[model samples]
Target: MKDVIVIGAGPSGSYAAYRLSKMGLDVLLLEEHKEVGKPVECTGLVSKRVLDFVKTRSIAGKVYGANIYFPNGKSIHVEKNDETIVLYRDSFDKDVAAMAIGAGADIRINARAISVKENNDSVTVKYRDSGQLKEDNAKVVIGADGINSVVRRDLYRIRQEKVVSTLQYDMAGKIEDERSVNVYLGSKYTHGFFGWAVPGGEIIRVGTGSYRASAYPYMKALSKRFGTNRVLGITGAGIPIKIAKSLFTKRSVLIGDAGGIVKPLSGGGIYTGIFSANLASERVANAIENEDYSQLRHYDKDIRGSIGVELKKDGFIQSIYSKIGDRSFDRIYGLISSEKIIDTINRSGDIDYPSKVIFKVLIRNPALLYSMWK
Candidate 1:
């Protein structure tokens, strides 16, 4: 039996396998897709902190600021020194998978995990590869599968969170400002969420997500507004909005979207997923070395303690947006477009962790509270 069996080959699974392999654990990474990255669903906008895990060679563009458009055609521009990179997710996933393989973890492609059964001492993973069914036993099982996870379904019975439907298109066009991303805020455009245009090397990616709206019409409208002609590629996926009720059981754990750790506001999961995976690896290693599978519970506690508060706060903010209309957003934008608020955001804003600077901004402009709450 292997020390660990990871059920997905995305960044989360690959990174967890890499970390476990580095710790000298026997790890097997499985990928359902034939290739590591294909039919990409993410916007691939990542902060510099992601560089610590993988070295990316294909950078579509870099964003140093954001232009937030309000309902009434008014906009607020926030600039920062730290830049966010638009990655080619295909290359990024391959890079992480290569790192895992280099660290002695075995990777199998076209292997889809169908079910998982936990015994007292070990866990068995049933999978199908090339039309052949196979089973593998591991001291621990880590489910890094995407939003629709079989592993999660097999291990525990918990209430699943709502999934946000997203649609994006890669259009052939020249963006006015490649260094800045554009976000459109209005119920007409995105329902409760927002529409975004991210510049790539030769194409601009325009997309949107919402809990109660269809994204295709919004994406089409955004593409028309951008005056883009050719659509090079299109992809869509369901993003989990809430964290899972339980992240682990006795001998099995879920990471990444399977754990529903995707950021509530931005729908970004790479950073949080990797963060959870890193924490899981430590606990998994300890569980294996000591022969006590209960140590896996630490992974759940650590993830919740580290990111649970942020997720809850973000969810609340999203709920506020969902309840309000366009005029309310315009009023809120009028209050936040000031130099003081903009300067504060430029100085302390973060895409991954917005709560860090949100409180400070709220403290500076108390009137904004009245706008949101009232």
Candidate 2:
């Protein structure tokens, strides 16, 4: 029996297992995927502030600005002071796995968790290992699995309130522009969400996102709009979003995507996942040592308090964004300074959603502000 069983060996899982193992707890990390960070769903564009939060050096692409396009063919170029890193997600995820291994956590690759059972003080995790199934016991279970987390389904009824399915691809062609990313804020191109152009290696990570049911159609539209005919094959998938508070249960904690730590605005969960895993590991270990596990609710509260306001504000912004007509978008796009746009994408995943800041900007421009309010 281990002290903790961490399901999913991605960013969140690795961080949780690492923290627990460092504290001398027997931590077992399970990963369903054969390896970490393949079929990369992330664009890997994160703010400078993210570097301060995440403790690894796995940067691949660096960006300084972005280009925003309205539905009316009007566009604005924006710049930022902070540098955002666009990493090769595969390398980054593998390195994160290394961190867990360094901390002495027992990692089982290709181990898919089947089910989990919790009885008062202990949790039993049944998983398939090396073509054979096995069951293990642990005092605590942390679900760090990605979007379609089995742990969440098995443990609790996760309310699907704020989830958006995102589709993206790592293309092979050389991007014409690599320094500044591209974003389209029109529902025609991407329904109820937006589309993006992220630079990775020699390919452009182009994709779109929306609510789950609409994701496939929206992604197809984006494919047609982005010159998919000229492009090679595309990669796509549903990105789990945590637009609201997460579900936490007894003797179990859901971290990262499993817990819905994704950015409400950008649908970026990598940074939030790692950060939550770190906190969960530390807090869970502390609880075990002190024999006071009642305050497990703190995990959810702490994450929400640190990131909730921003996420809520961004959610509101995205709501206003996807509804805007072409003409309204043009006026608002004009009101939105290039400086603001650049700064937004660069640091969007790190700090609070700039709602208060947007309010101030709107006050300066009445017509644009009024549109947002509506």
Candidate 3:
């Protein structure tokens, strides 16, 4: 039996395995795909804080700011000294998994976990490997899987309440400003979410998310508005806008998208997921070494104490953002487009903790609150 079993070799899983194995624990990392990060679905835009978690070489491009467009044709520009790293997501996943393997964690590719059963002393995972049935036993199981996680569903009987279906195309064409991303905000473009155009080196990634209907039509419309529809590649993903209520059980815990540990505003999970994984590794190690399985509950408490505060705020903001119509968005944009508010945003805006700017803006211009109410 292994000391720890990490399902799904994404950044969170790989990082957890890497940390535990480095501590001399017998860890097993499993990947369903033959390759580590194949069928990439992410826009790959992440903050520099990701570097603090893992040193990587999957950088594709960098942008220093964002241009947010409202439905009324007005926009707000926010810039910062720090740049957002556009990653080659496939290479990024491979890099993290390599770190785990280097740290003595055994990894199995083409391994799909079908079911997980938690016993009093250990957890058993049944999976299909190369079309053959296999099983592994571990003192603790960490479900670092994606949004549609078998471990989360089978073990916890949990499901995401609301998820945004997104679609994007990598278009080969000219980009207006490669230094900044373009954000289109409105229910007209996307019902529950918004549209985005992120510049890569040679291609611009154009995508949209929808809550009421298909995101394809909205994405196509967004690509048309951007004036570049020549496609290079296409990708789609589902983002859980709400965090899961239950993340830990007797002998198992879910991390990353599986636990809905993503940002509600931006739907970015890398930083938060890996951050939780780091915390989880400590708790898991302590539980195993101390032989107190109940200690695993602290992982949930630890997460709620840290990023959970930020996620809670972001979720409240998203609830309003999703329900607001184009008129409200236009009004909000007009109210916040001032030089003073822009400066406040530029100073406080963080991709990882986005709600900071909103609070700061409200504090500076209390009129914005009345404007929101109206």
Worst 10 residues of 3 by lDDT: 220-229
lDDT tens string, model 3, 98-206?
9999999999999999999999889999998988999999999999989999888988998888798999888886578889999999876787788999998778888
Number of clashes recorded per candidate: 0, 1, 0
Better of 1 and 3 by lDDT: 3
Each model's TM-score?
Answer: 0.97, 0.90, 0.97
- In model 2, pairs of residues that clash are 310-353
**Stretches > 4 Å off in candidate 3:** none
The window of 10 residues in a row where model 1 has the poorest summed lDDT is 156-165
**Residue 150 miss distance in model 3 (angstroms):** 1.2
Residue lDDT tens for model 2, 1-374: 78899999887888788778988999999988787776566778766655664566788778777777787767777666666788777777888888889989999998999899888888899999977999999888898877777778788766546667667765665555677788887766677678888776667778888764566676676666546555654666666555435546787888888877777667877777877887787778877887777767787787777766666677777676656666667767766655754454444423335565565565555677666555
The predicted structure with the larger TM-score, 2 or 3, is: 3
Tell me which residue pairs clash in candidate 3. none
Q: Per-prediction RMSD in angstroms?
A: 1.3, 2.9, 1.2
